[model samples]
Target: MRERGFRLIRLLEYAGLLVVLIATLAAAGQEIALMYRQGRVTVADLLMLFIYLELLAMNGIYWRAGRLPVRMPLYIAIVAMARHLTLETPDMNAWTTLAEGGTVLLLSLAVLVVRYGHIRLPYRDEDPDNIGGRRS
Candidate 1:
């Protein structure tokens, strides 16, 4: 029964992921179409496309690995913050701009810390049941 439940849950996860992947592709296509209509691509358009690419990569990695890395979302967040600041800089107040810049910096530092931890303290086992690879 437990195994059956896990299987069902995994099926739902795959379905959800497939939906997200399709939606992302559609959005990217729309963005490209809009750029074509405008006859030129701007920095904001490029950043938005880059975000889509990152989402696709993240989806692919999750599908293959059965696990999502913490860094992938962090990278996406950093790019998103940059994009937001770029688009809003003209009208944004000084404090708001500083806050956004600080957020990007913090996310970058988080990525570095996660990378360091993964390298310095590598996982010894792939078993999910084995917490931290410590034997009971």
Candidate 2:
């Protein structure tokens, strides 16, 4: 029974991953179409595209390794906050702009911390075949 439950949960996880992959691809396609129609891409659009790419990367890494790194989401968040700030800058108040900038700064710091931890303290049984390989 326990094994069957585990299998069921795994199946659901794969199904969810499939949904996420499809949604990300569809959104990316839509963005590209909009850019094509407009005949030019803005920085905000580029930042949004980066967020989509990061989401796709996160999904791919999880699908391949059965684990999602903490950094991918941080990268996505940083790009997202930047995109928001870019799009809303014209109408945002000074305090709001400063708060958003601070949010991006905090996310950047989080990425640094995560990277530092991954380098200074890693999993004991790290997989040799993984992309970064085992860290000493």
Candidate 3:
């Protein structure tokens, strides 16, 4: 019974992920279409697209591995901070800009730490195929 319940939960997770994947794709398509109509792509627009790309990659990783890495969202946050800074610099005060930049720097450092930890103390039975990072 527990195994069946787990299967049901996993099925629901797949369904939810599928919805997110579709939404991400649709949003990306709309962004592209809007850019086409505008006839010009600003750095902000490119950054938005890159964020979408990262989301898709995150989703793909979760689907393939049944686990999400700690770094993907941090990377997204860093990109988002940069995008926010770029778009808001004209109106942002120096303090706010500095804070946002610092946020990005902190997130970058976090990624490095997580990566180092993974390398220096990897799972003893991590699966190279990314299948739940467990040995059979």
User: Could you say which candidate leads in lDDT?
Assistant: 1
Model 3 root mean square deviation, Cα atoms: 3.8
Cα deviation at 18, candidate 1, in Å, is 0.3
Query: How would you order the candidates by lDDT, starting with the best?
Result: 1, 3, 2
Best by TM-score: 1
RMSD of each: 1.6, 5.2, 3.8
* TM-score of each candidate structure, all chains considered together: 0.92, 0.86, 0.89
Candidate 3 local lDDT, 1-136, one digit each (tens) = 8668778988999999999999999999999999999999999999999999999999999999887899999999999999999899999999998899899999999999999999998755454445565545
Error of 3 at 18 (Å): 0.4
lDDT of 1 by residue, 17-129 (tens): 99999999999999999999999999999999999999999999989988788999999999999899989999999999999999999999999999999999876756645
lDDT by residue for model 2 (43-125), tens: 99999899999999999999998778999998998989989988999999999999999999999999999999999998554
Q: Give me the runs in candidate 3 sitting further than 4 Å from their true place.
A: 124-136
TM-score of 2: 0.86
Q: How many angstroms is residue 94 displaced in model 1 relative to the true structure, after the best TM-score fit?
A: 1.1
lDDT of each: 0.92, 0.90, 0.91
Clashing pairs in 2: none
